[model samples]
Target chain A: MEAQTIVQPEKKKSNQDVIIIKHLNKSFGSNKVLVDFNINLEKDENLVVMGKSGSGKSVLIKCIIGLLEPDSGTIEIFGRNIPDLDRNELDEIRAKVGFLFQGNALYDSMTVRQNLEFPLRRHWMNVNQPEVNKLVQEALDDVGLKHTINMMPAELSGGMRKRIALARTLILKPEIILYDEPTTGLDPGTAKEIIELIVAIQKKYRSSSLIISHDMNCVRLAADRVVMLIDGRCYAEGTYDSLKKSGDPKIKDLIE
Target chain B: MALPVKTTDFLQETGGISVFTGRFFKEAFKPRYEISEFLRQCFVIGYRSLPLIGLTGFIMGLVLTMQLRPSLIEYGVESQLPAMVGIAIVREIGPVITALIFAGKIGSSIGAELGSMKVTEQIDAMEVSGTNPFKYLVVTRVAASTLMLPILVMISDAISLFGSYIGVNINGITSFPLFYTQVFNNLGFSDVLPAFVKSFFFGFAVGIISCYKGFYSNKGTEGVGQSANSSVVISSITIFVIDLIAVQITNVLNLN
Candidate 1:
């Protein structure tokens, strides 16, 4: 018998039409949070959302992930309206989109390995133990924390914890990564390191990303396109230099 | 002004019930255990609360012994006072009173911590990271409570009996060995097991409901306080409800 290579068709299909949010609106009782929010992400594009706190930056991404229900709007990921999907369907959507929480919200009880392995076990049943282990190690390597896999989240420094959280996001090979304030409280040097990691991961995985942050340095480092959220809407949309020089008072204040 | 008060009261009541029932199933099997966080919770829920539970149990035993001494004398069965009070403490009063104390001390703290985390978007961070906060936060705390409270109750029961022994000797002449023998003679597997089992449910209820209130809290700073208050209130009510059901079932089995 002649030696032959088996080709995988599913792996070749591109995750191009990733996420689309249209005219989404949300309110808490009478206080409106997101008002007519719209955005579309192409494959492997890094879109950064900049806004003051409470401007619904997190809420908008949450709606995309189907964590929050927008009162009236359509969120279509890969051409499927997400809000219409049931719980199982939403879980499927979530599996493909990795999120790094603002606080690096690592589970405090589990070791770093357990934390990284948790989603893999829950969502990837076909993956056996050895394969899971290899993937986890690889993820840790990518985040430069391969040595700290057994350590608990509490034992890690702020940057190390953030890196572990990133490793966790990579474990599932997600196509879209949403970062919520990836560098909010870290020292300037550590924040810069996180920003570098974000860019490296985006390029390495060729993954589409939507980052919600107020950190201008991070915005400049990681954003291919920046969208400023103000008053429950996209206030300005442009590249970093364009946004910086736009001369709009609010945009200027945010940049300066 | 009147309408807002009515609305607030209505929300408080309905939210309590909704949170209790919703958290019961949600926390039962969620993935991602927060170990260090849970231990910290245990320290708060089990260790720190020990003093309060201990004080109450001791006083309960002493007061019950004193109050019943007169009545037992009236029946000319003053010699049986130790055994009667011991059985009461071991069989029902011990677990119930200790659990009530647990609810007040631990339940409210869980509620407040979770509520503050929720208000601050920490819970949302967990959910967005492909981790189920319900499983991580609620399950571990509830499970810890389920495991810890029974142990706590057992310890409390022993201490209370000791206190009762001292109370008996305050006015009469009963040796320590005789006091314990009388107490144990009236207590069987029937009395001890059912009371102990019911406490697990009480602990589970307290942990789950408190976590649910705190995890889903939305109104900001005031919501944290509301969650803490409701956790204690609802868990206390649930303890009684479970006790009644447990008693009824125990009667049906002729086990008590």
Candidate 2:
């Protein structure tokens, strides 16, 4: 029951690319993190990017969110270059792109319910309170944490915190979700449950995702297509099986 | 490497802070204000600090009055004790002391809170969730400190004056009404207005410095401690610096 074999038939054109990065280049004081990198994320697809530690996986996600500026490249989300957009414009696009951090980045001071409400309050100021409560509950229920809404992030276990963070991301109804190391710190069983939830949410919302992870279980289960990042560039890209079966030592080193 | 390079680096750091301040200005005025969060911060930074500020103010006034009594008695000016202490406390000591206490308490709290958020990626998560963490966290907290410090200082001044009256009574029989009359008789617009005006700046300085330190914190767990420690140190120094400039301006304007 390989997870890659369960992916459905694709239906998309070149114009349906939700995210496209062309010749991306980023450097930090001679530490070149990305160079001559290009990637396209299609609509309604789960694309997992696998890289070793310090291999620029998180940097790529930050560039997409406009948190990091690339030196010489265009990251076009719905055909708008991320680096060229001003802060306000970047904020506008950020509403459409949800990012799940590795650490579950929930606000420590806020309750789970308040965390979910924050996105709605920011983007849809005119929406009334009843509607907000409804949406907040809906997002929480989606992650099976509706009962924990009133709890502070500290009160929740590690896995619950991660789910709460996911619920916060989902509350915005984003068209694309970017996950960074989605299963890094959790127990194996908890990590598998999170992987299942990731897939379930993607199917339920029909949202495309760009997941950056080194966890093989997550990549194997959640990826419709896998991209290998090595030397700050996309070393290979294909279905998990195609790369897993390849003779490239690097790919073998990763998937095997 | 070189002296010029070191100077340039310092300039670059200053420019970065300037840009961050500009961003706060730009984002704070836009629509979708976090009124509730702002109020919450007011409660946290202002209401919660009441006891500490009050305690310090009382002690400051009592000690100053006790120490000044021997010298005043020797000069045959013991009767002017209330007037002198009232003018000194209202005009300078009260606000500056209250702000230093605030920088110690609220400044460190903000720095540590936001620095922890930064290290754990909560700030980035907020940005991705379409929420302006600056508005929700930085602007609200800064605005609260800027607006609340003056109020806190006013309360501290009143409490301090009461403590001074008690201190005066400890040495001799100065009735409450008489003591209050002496205090009010010597106070004028010049004594009160400038101190109130300068308090706003003190609050904003502490708020912004702490936010700046925390927002740009780096490394990991160690960075959180550094942010908190530096925030207090910088904010304390900034309060004194602001007080110096404020005193100079007031003196030149004949507001002393």
Best by TM-score: 2
Q: What digit string (tens of lDDT, one per residue) describes model 2 on residues A110-186? A: 89888888878777778999999999989989999899989999899999999998998898899999998989899
Clashing pairs in 1: A109-B34, A109-B35, A109-B36, B115-B214
Alpha-carbon DockQ of candidate 2: 0.66
DockQ of each: 0.35, 0.66
Per-residue alpha-carbon lDDT of model 2 for B176-231, expressed as tens digits?
99999999999999999999999999999899989988998898989999999989
Which ten contiguous residues of candidate 2 chain A have the minimum total lDDT? Answer: A1-10
* Error of model 2, residue B188, in angstroms: 2.1
* Candidate 1 wrongly placed segments (more than 4 Å): A1-15, A245-253, B1-11, B22-77, B90-92, B116-122, B129-132, B135-159, B162-205, B218-230, B233-256
Judged by DockQ, which candidate is best? 2
Model 1: per-residue Cα lDDT at residue A146:
89
